[model samples]
Structure formats: structure tokens, C-alpha cells
Target: MSPDLWSFALAVYARPDVEAACLRLQSAGANVCLMLCGLWLEQRDATCDDRRVHQLRQITDPWDRDVVQPLRALRLQWKEAADTDPLLKGMREQIKGMELEAERALLSRLEGMAQGWARNSKESSDWLEALAGEAANLNRDALRVLRVAAAGA
Candidate 1:
């Protein structure tokens, strides 16, 4: 793993909250593939040859096998209802148009990780931190949009 990647992963693993969140998120049947895939896509601009990418890819299988199926099932669960929910309709449309490059970028990062880096809890923590930070930023933006919508201004 490159120094940056190694450091990022280490930081992610160091934070107890992040570590717990990762495990909880995984166990809670959260969409790991989609989450990681989204992260990878979002971070592609800053990524490059690195060991972390490789390990990330390796982990994606569990997500592909265990997570996506259920999500797809749920997505179709309320097709009629979705028509009334613009958010659901937009989300469905976005999912349908999800860019493949983002998915591939995340898989590449995981795959690129060196063996030691991939196995290290500290390293994983660092990566999680980066992911969490990105998520937080997204939440902030979404909240801002929500506030604006709520204000009707």
C-alpha cells in the first residue's frame, strides 16, 4: 500500500466510532456494495496505484452476493408507491444510471492494497474515516437542500 492509502486506512481503523459503524453497517444489512461503490466513485479523482484498492475490491463480493439482491428486491417492493414519492423515483432513476467507473474505482482501490495493509485494522480505520468524512459532507449538503425546500424560499 502507498503511504497515503496506508495512512488513510490506519486512521479509519483507529476511530472506534468508525470501526463500530463499519461493522454495524455491515451487520445491519446495509448496502456495503453500494456504499463502498459510491465512495469509490466519489473518490476516483484522488485515487491511483495503491494496495487499499485491491482489498476493497476483494471485500466487495460479500456486498455483491449478500447486499445488492435485497436492495433490488426492496427497490421493486413499492413500484406503485414509488410513483407518488419523487425522492424514491429520483433514487431509482439514479441507481439505474449509476456510473460504472465509480464502481470500478472502488474495486480497484481494494484490490491494490498490499496484503499487510489489507489485513490491518488500523489501516481499514483510516479508509473508513475518509469514507465517513465524505458521507458527512454529503449529509450536510442534503440537509442544506432540505432546509431550503422546507423554507419554500
Candidate 2:
């Protein structure tokens, strides 16, 4: 696995079924960035706690809502039209790039927030499950895919 969060996320995302599973979790209202961060924490053997989770959420929620979501919505909104119109397709692709940039920025912020934490001396915390909360319950298979992918990554 990569040392940095962005590279770590890319590696995990490249694993088989990982993208599909992440999309499923995202559709189910899980923040893909948060999930990736959780996996990163798990890999680092960092202990999960309520305060940390809440702190992460505080950093994530607004940025995702205000920055990423709008870009994504605009890009998705142009999907069908962009399929037929080359010009529209180009613009939509740009929006997609912006969305990715936004996500990458979010991951950086998450990494910064987590950087000071020391690794646990004992067993690893289930950051994925703790971070996912009820969303994990709703998307068990998807979550499982992520866990397997993260393990491989």
C-alpha cells in the first residue's frame, strides 16, 4: 500500500470490484473519501474512536456538500446530452476532472487531519465499519469488497 492517502486510495480503488463496490456505497450515502480514509487508518493500525470519527465527519460533510456534490451533479446532469454532443461531452469531462480534484483535495484534508495520530500498539480498529456506521449494514457486500480490496492494497 502507498504511504500517502491519495496513492493508497488509488491503489485500493484499482483492485477488482473495488470501484463498483465504492459506487454502490456512494449511492447508499456513504462518503467514498471517508471510506478510503477509514481503510487508510485501518492499514496504519490507528485506533478508531468517536471523537476522531466526529472530527473526520466535521471536516468531510460540508466540503463534500459544498464543493464536490455540485460539480458531480452538473457532470451527471450532462451525461445523456454529452453522449451525443461532442462539445457538451468535452465540458462534462472537465466537470468530471473538477470533481476528481475536489475529491483529491478532500482526501488531502483528511490525511492532514489524521497525520498526528499514533499507530495502535495492539489490534487494528475496524475503521471501515465504524466509519460506515449504518451504511455498512445496508451495503454489506459492497463494504466487504472494500475491505478485501484494502487488504490487498
Candidate 3:
């Protein structure tokens, strides 16, 4: 991982829709960095962390799948809008960048905790709890960014 991995993660984490989608993915048993990285890689047309991303991609539960679809769709929508509108495009790119940087920053600490348990282990409930804590922090940071962005507008 690069030294700026956290920066990359934070870039993605700045987006409200991205953050919300990630929380939904976390609620559905996906790791936060993996989820955000999946979106990042998808946006850049690069490869994802295949094992973790693949596991998420293979989720068969309808409820879980449904929750993530909005995330996937939001990424596409943001990407598309970002490519077109000159006015909002810069902000869209900023949000995507923050999302990635936030994930990278937060995951440096969290991934170690996440790797301790087996993928199919019974630690999911606990993982969800931990994720909620992380999500709250991310949400708070995002809200601050939103306030600044809104105030500047």
C-alpha cells in the first residue's frame, strides 16, 4: 500500500452518497476499505482487492444485494455526472477522492482487526458493531466537510 493510501481512502469517504452506500455495505457484511476500494477501482477502471471484493460481489442474499445496488448505482451516477457537468464536476471529483483517502486512512488501523477473524467466522455481529463505530466517525468527518462545502457555496 502507498503512503497516501489513507489519503486516497479519505477522498472517497468525503462523498455523502458514497459514505451512505458504504455504511449499507458494512451493514451487509462487507469490509469498509474493500467496499470503498471496489468503488475506487471501478471508477478508475483498475483492479480491486479481488478476494475481498469478490466475496462482496458474490453475496446472494436479496436484502444484502439490494442494499449494495444503490451503492453501485450511485458510483456510476456520480462518475457520469462528474464526467459531464463542468460546474459540479470538480466537487464530484473531490468527493470521490476524499472517499478513497478516508477509507485508506481509517483502514490502516481497522484492516488488522478485520483480518484477525475468518471470513465465514461468527465474528460478523461484532464486526458490524466495530463498523458502526468507524462509520460514525466517518459520518462526522463527512458532515464537517459538507458544512464547509455548503458554507463556501
Candidate 4:
């Protein structure tokens, strides 16, 4: 396994069914960066208690809200125009890259924060659920699918 969060995330995200499950969770208002962090923690066998969840959220939410969201918004805002305007299309691609890089930065920070945490034998599904909490639009089935994918089941 990779020693860093970004590489770990890339590996897990490429696993079967994970991409679709992540997209489903993302559409339901879950922060994908946080979700990826949760998986990273799981891979590290970290404990998934409420306090840890809260701590993780505190570390990630601000960067996700302030930086990543804005870039995503800008890229999305150009979606329609990008279809026709070649210049806008190029600019939108650049914004998309920046957004991904911002996410990578957040993952790096999250990994740093979690580096010294004690590891446990907790189930990855439990960690995933704890990190994800209860999103209004993420139904139980969707969560189950996510869990299955996270577990590589």
C-alpha cells in the first residue's frame, strides 16, 4: 500500500465500483475528499470514534468549503459555455486541474493529521459511516454500496 494519502486514494478510487459509489455519495452532498480520507484512515486501520470523526471534519471542512468548492463552482459554471467556446473549454479544464490539486492538498493535510493516530481493528465500513455521517440524500442502499466498494467486497 502507499504510504501517503493521495496515492492511497488513487488506488482505492480505482477499485471496482468505487468511482460510481463515490459519485453517488457526492451527488448526495457528501464531500468526496473527506470520504477518501475516511478510506485512507480505514486502510491505516485507524480508530473511528466520534471524537476522531469530529477532529477529521474540523481539519478538512474549512479547506473543502473555502478552496475546493469555489474551484468546482467555477468549473461547473463554465460547463455550458465550454461546449461551444474553445477558450472557455480550455480555461475550464485548467480550473478542473486546479480543483483536483486543491483536493490533493487537503488529502495531504489529512494524512499528516492522522499519521500519529493509534491504529485499531475497526471495520472499514464503520469508519466510512462514521466519517460520512447522515447525508439527506444518501439512502441506505447507496451507503451499502459504498461500504461494499470500500471493503473491496
Candidate 5:
């Protein structure tokens, strides 16, 4: 629970069904990094509140929209051509790595944001819903798997 967000994210993401669930949620427009940060907070028993949520969005929105998304878009755009071109495939792989690094950086920022928050004794918080926002309904099954896996984390 005390693990840094990156480590926590890696551990939880490696669990069975987690990657597929995360991909589904991502395809539905959920920020997988934010959701992972939410899971970290949940595991740490941090209280979920509107102000913190707002702050998180503030920190995430610009970085995600400006940085991460572009890399993702580029990687996706190259996917079809990369399959036929070895050079393009290698470059696309690099973009994929960059995208992952961008996410890791975002998670570090999120962990820093929660540094002063105190953990509570409650068994759970409403973070998954709060973080998922509108995308929650679009992928309940994915969220369920993610939630269960994170709870174990």
C-alpha cells in the first residue's frame, strides 16, 4: 500500500485480466494513469473528496492532453504501416516506450499531489467512480476487474 505509484501501478497492472481491463477502459476514454493513481490512493486508504479530485484533474488534464495523448496518437497512427515496415515498427516501438514513460511521469506527479493526505481506517473509498467519471458506465466490467485487482493490491 505504501509503494510508490509507479511500483503499485506495475504490480497491479501485471495481475491477470488487469491489462485487458485497463485497455478497455482506455479505449472508452478513461485516463489509465489517473485510474491507476486512484487505485493507489484507494489502497493507501486516502479519503476521496471533490477538492482532491479537482486538483488531480488539474494536474493530469494538461499533461495528458498535451503530451501523452499525442504520443499515443502517433503510435496508433503508425500501427498499420509499422506492421509492414521494419524501420517503422522500431520507431513505433520507441514511441510506445515514450508514451509509457510519460504515464510514469504523470503517476509520479499524482503521488506527489497526495503526499500530505492522511490515510483513514475505512475499508474502501469511492475513488474508482470518482476517477472514472463518465466512462464508468461505458465499461463497468473492466472497472469491476480493475477494482477487485486493486483492492488486493
Candidate 6:
């Protein structure tokens, strides 16, 4: 059976420098969910191209903007208070769990969208490039780190 998106995401994000790389990419206007999906597709040897990347953005942009980002923002907003208030700390943790669930749902949707895509023999590096194209500010060093980590995976 094919690996599920959540599990794949967990494994990839656990890799050395991957989380940092993803955060860097996210700060540069790239969607981390899309980046995770790109890595999953690469692991599956699926074709990665501009059209596919566009399709991924269309599938995820709304959810990210509507659900995930709000949860994240709220969690961050509560961080200061949560540090001092025990009750707020628990609430913040709950919000963090919800945010994670939202991301999982997004990954599942992405997996569904790419379900019928034909697999190819393209190198995983190509997939990173395709996803990176969406980020206007991802620097060369960051891209190199991401590519190396992804290629190693």
C-alpha cells in the first residue's frame, strides 16, 4: 500500500534540517503544506511541473488561509499568556493540536488531488525545484539545504 501523507510528512519533517528548511521556506511566502506534498510526490516518483504545482496551490491555498493560519496565529497570540497562565497553557496546547489536525487534513486533500497523477522517473530534486518556483524569496542557500535534505530522503 502507498504510504499515507501524514506519516510521510512526519518522517520527512523529522529529518535533520528539514523542519528548519521548511520554516525558512514558509517565511519566504511558500506554503509548507505544498512543500510537504511536493516531497511526498517526489518520494512516490510522481511528475512535478508548473501545472501540478498550480493544482496543489489551488487545492490548499484556501484551507491554509482560512483554517491553518488562523489557528497558528491564535496559538502564537496566546503564547505569552500561556507561559504564565496554566489554564491558557492547556488551551494553547489544544489549539496547537487543532492546528496540526488542520494540516493533516490539508495533506490528505493534497494526496487525493495527486492520486491519479502518473508516476515518472524524475529525480526528487526536480520536485523541490517545482515547489520552490512558487516562492519568490527562497534564497540559494536555503534551496540548497532543502534540496540536499530532500534528495537524501
lDDT of 4 by residue, 1-153 (tens): 677888878877887777878777787778787888877677678877888788889988899889999999999999998999999999999999999999999998888888888888543325677776676246556666655665662
lDDT of 6 by residue, 17-80 (tens): 8888888888888888887777777767887777888888888889999999999999999999
Ranking by TM-score: 2, 5, 4, 6, 3, 1
* Model 1 worst lDDT window (10 residues): 144-153
Query: What TM-score does candidate 6 reach?
Result: 0.86
Q: Pairs clashing in candidate 2?
A: none
Q: Which candidate tops lDDT?
A: 2
- In order of listing, the candidates' clash counts read 34, 0, 25, 0, 0, 0
lDDT of each: 0.42, 0.92, 0.44, 0.79, 0.89, 0.79
The residue pairs in collision within model 4 are none
TM-score each candidate. 0.27, 0.96, 0.31, 0.87, 0.93, 0.86
Estimate, for each residue in 27-111, the C-alpha lDDT of model 3 and write its tens digit.
5555655444333333333322335433433442342345434444565577767777886677666666655454444454433
Q: Please, what are the lDDT tens digits per residue for candidate 2 over residues 1-153?
A: 689999999999999999999988888889999999999998888988888999999999999999999999999999999999999999999999999999999999999999888788875577888788778999999988988999898
Q: RMSD to the native, candidate 5?
A: 1.7
Best by TM-score: 2
Model 6 stretches astray by more than 4 angstroms: 121-125, 134-137, 151-153
Q: Is candidate 2 or candidate 5 better by lDDT?
A: 2
Ranking by lDDT: 2, 5, 6, 4, 3, 1
Residue 1 in candidate 5 has what lDDT? 58
Tell me the spans in candidate 2 whose CA falls farther than 4 Å from its real position: none
RMSD of each: 14.3, 1.1, 16.0, 2.5, 1.7, 2.5
- Write one digit per residue (lDDT tens) for candidate 5, span 24-79: 88888888998899888877789898989899999999999999999999999999
- In model 3, what lDDT does residue 136 have? 43
